[model samples]
Target: MSTTPPPDISFEQDALGRLILIAPGGTRHVNVHPAKMFPLTEKDHWISIQSENSREILCVEDPQTLPEPSRSLLLGALARRDFVPIIQVIHRIVRMADGHQWHVTTDRGDTTFEVETDESIQNLGHGRLVIVDRRNTRYLIPSVPSLDRVSKRKLEHYY
Candidate 1:
């Protein structure tokens, strides 16, 4: 079986901190963003670069295939775009008029956020859960079974 070669693309950050894509043959696409096709699963592979209006500019199968500065630049952009905090401890969950307010400590630090509804908490199976806050920020619970007793009890009502 013949494998498709990686896209011949590179990246550059402008003075304003916008991601610029340098395609093959010196074609440049300015102010682009790298979005992971499989962000929750195969994060490092299958990235799509999109324009300001979300138009697909190019698809990179693997950032590792790209040469030096390009690979680093692409990975850096992906890091800034995908920021899902891993919840380590659930301090408290208070019921609000609209939804529930969650106070938890994540891998990043302590934070409090509101969940608009039960539907916002998604179960990805195998004890993996994703809690999306009202602002659309996501917090990941990699393994429900691995959480402490107190934390598990706090989440029992949801699951």
Candidate 2:
């Protein structure tokens, strides 16, 4: 970890909920987004600051070291950017020659995604599961055992 001075990070939102970033160069009206350089391992240590157009502005080496308000603001934006709906109900899991189809209900609503194979569902050690679809979107099943009996039975063939 760098012991260097922390970069000034701050933010504001427009009427449409668009983000505005404040920096030493002055406030820039950007659709700024927070991207973790390491999503699973480091979590909050390194982050990429990108614009709405997906352009990289800068990378913060450590968020925990930022000044109080700045740290909170950056973390809040990161939290929103990292939103992933949890699958609560697995209505069905269909196996196919090419791929598998999943019909499930998430915290957000009902949705379906295709998984290329049973390998797509990763057993994250313990009861947790993470399913990556064909398009690369991830559906988090926080705990496999916590799922309803029907979902567990359907998920058995995969893991």
- Number of the top-ranking candidate, with TM-score as the measure: 1
* lDDT for 1 (candidate 2): 23
Tens digit per residue, CA lDDT, model 1, 1-159: 112245666788899988898877778888898888877788778898898899887788878998878788888889889999999999999999999999999999999999999999999889989999999998999999999999999999776
Leading candidate by lDDT = 1
Clashes of 1: 0
lDDT of each residue in 30-148, candidate 2, tens digit only: 77887887665577687887877887777788878887666887788888778567999999988788998899999999999899987888887678788989988878888888999
Q: What is the C-alpha lDDT of each candidate?
A: 0.87, 0.79
For candidate 1, the per-residue lDDT at 1 reads 16
What candidate 2 gets wrong by more than 4 Å, as runs, is: 1-33, 41-45, 49-62
Going through the candidates in the order shown, the clash numbers are 0, 0
